[model samples]
Target: MGKLLIQGGIPLEGRVPISGAKNSTLPVMAACFLAQGETILENIPEITDVDVVMEICREMGGEGEWLERGVIRLHVPDTISCKTSYTLAKKLRASNLLLGALLGRFGWAEVALPGGDNIGTRPMDLHIKGLSVLGAELKIEHGYIRGGVAGGKRLKGGKIYLDFPSVGATENIMMAAAMAQGQTIIENCAKEPEIVDLANFLNAMGARIRGAGTDVIRVDGVSELRGTRYTVIPDRIEAGTYMIAAAATHGRVIVENVIPTHLHAITSKLREIGVRVEEGDDQIFVDGAGLFRPVDVKTLPYPGFPTDMQSPLMALLSTVKGISMIVENVYENRLRVVDELQRMGAQIKIEGRTAVIDGVARLSSAQVKASDLRAGAALIIAGLMADGETEVSCLHHVLRGYAHLEEKLTGLGARVRRIS
Candidate 1:
């Protein structure tokens, strides 16, 4: 096991380039199964989650290799296996996406139940419902989600209305519907930028898809899909984390290679908390040398404040002047990180799905363990704002999402080191 030893009190400054979206890369790599030729992907993040997804893709008979730094060459075969490794599939949540891609391609898929950060109940019911509506037969047997189209035939497109705007479900339905027999319309679907990126990728390969940035989406099925090269969007969640970190430590940071519009939700929240944010064509500048005000945050789907950022934002809010509250409408147990933050002298309380925080004048360093990916990042932010030293353990979770996190923070003048 490894841990991050951090000495607090340094203001982070300089440019930290945002990596490609891990959420976007996984589904796009899974979508490669729908095509039958070479697909080149650029700006892929060097994260453990990407490694897991690529391994799963290889297990399904697709050949993938790194062409250069942040570039990958994937050759999807005409015929691929429908069964995925249970051991590998359980390692990450994106493995569940393989069911839709494999089912769309081979008309059958036997994938294991997925596992990732234990933040909340992320079931595959919506995925199965959408796929089933698109003419798939899904069933959970043993530990795998088994079944596909009846008689091994092509999936027929049908309208699917999601009860909630689940991002994974929306992407699964979109991928399966892309190769269906007819037109498919999805109502109340997730409108995240990653969803639009996936739609753009699929459309680039001849699938007719529209209304991606809205709650409604339309997909006209194509008989065959050819591979195409694509680039992924930058990680907005990572950018938000850095922005919040700068505020917590009263630093100036330029988060580069990001789409400013994609971060409107985060930027607005930071501004509300008295942080100065400037937007350029593709970069966001965050200056945090002023007093912060306590604000209420509610995590909503897409266009709203993201649930992934709630933990880190809460860490920053802990140093504000007054009381702040964060309503986690997306995940149930996300506030579980409050215990670790409390170890660092943060005054936080959980009332149901809401976290009531009383901002402290300062925080003292403590030894803490990262419970999940985003929570791990929240600890690092807290460590940077605290006095003395803080050691954050269980770095595997943080590595699953952020790429070269220590190096990035170090470049920004934060005193952090990885120790075994």
Candidate 2:
């Protein structure tokens, strides 16, 4: 196992480029199944989830390779087997998305339930409801989600109203509706930029989609899709992470290659905490003085403070002034990192879905473990701000999302070393 030993008190400076959006890449990879020929993708993040998704594609008879530093070539051919093995699907929660793509392509999909972070109970009921409305028969037998088209091998068009603006359900329904026989409308769809990016990429390949970055989405069924080369949108969450890290460490970091508008929620929060934030064309500058004010945060869907960033922001709030209260509205069990942060002498209390954090002057070094991906990143940032050396174990979780994280931190003047 690889672990990161972070030596604290370095102000991270220099320019760092953001990687591709993980949320967009997953659906775009699934979009390969709809292509009649090969699809080439650019700026792919070198995360473990990428490899897992590639394995899923390979199992379904797709070939892929890294064409460049951040480019991938995927060929699904004319036909693909529509089975997602239990072992494969359990690697990540996004694996459930293959069901919609496979069902649209082959009229059947027998996949296992997805597994990822234990933040909360992410239900597939919305996904099933949206697909079932398009004439799919879904059932959970043993541990596998067995589903297929009922009447024919074609998907019938229908309107799907989601109970929540779930990212997964929105992507799943989009994939299923892309190749349907008629028209499909999805109401209250997720309005995240990643979802919109996926829709744009699919539309480039002859899929008809409209109103992506809005609550309402409309799709017209297409007869077939052709190969297309596409570049993924920059990761807002990763950009937000770096911005928070800069704030927590009293560092001045100019993060580049990001959509400044996408970071409105994070940027606003940082400004509220007395951090000097400046935004330019696709870049954001954060200057910190190590002094912070505790603020209230309630995690919500897009345009609201994201739940993925809750842990990292909490780490930043730990060393600030006053008490900070964070209510996790998106995930019930997202406070998995609360215990680990406390190991470093953080004053945080968990009361049900709310986390009450009392500010401390500084954190002392401790050997802590990463509970999940985002939590792992939060701990790394905490370690960077701690008073002494902090060793973070179970680092594989961190690698599932961030690409070359230590290298990026090292570039920003952080004294972090990875060891076996």
| Local accuracy by lDDT, each model | 0.93, 0.90
Off by over 4 Å in 2: none
Query: Per-residue lDDT of 1-420 in model 2, one digit per residue for the tens?
Result: 589999998888988999998888988998788888888899899888988988888887888778888889888876677777789788788898888887887788887899988778998999999999988999998787897899767898999999899999999889888998899999999999999998999899999999999999999989888889999999899999999999888999999989999999999999988999999998999999745788999999999999999999999999887988999999988899999999999999999999999999998889999988899999999998999999999998889899989889999999999999
The Cα RMSD in angstroms, rounded to one decimal, for candidate 1 relative to the true structure is 0.8
TM-score of each: 0.99, 0.98
lDDT per residue as tens, model 1, 71-173:
8878779777888899998878999988888888889999999998999999999999999998999899999999979778999989899999999999999
In candidate 2, list every pair of residues with a backbone clash: none
For candidate 2, give the lDDT: 0.90
Candidate 2 shows a clash count of 0
Provide the lowest-lDDT 10-residue window in model 2: 77-86
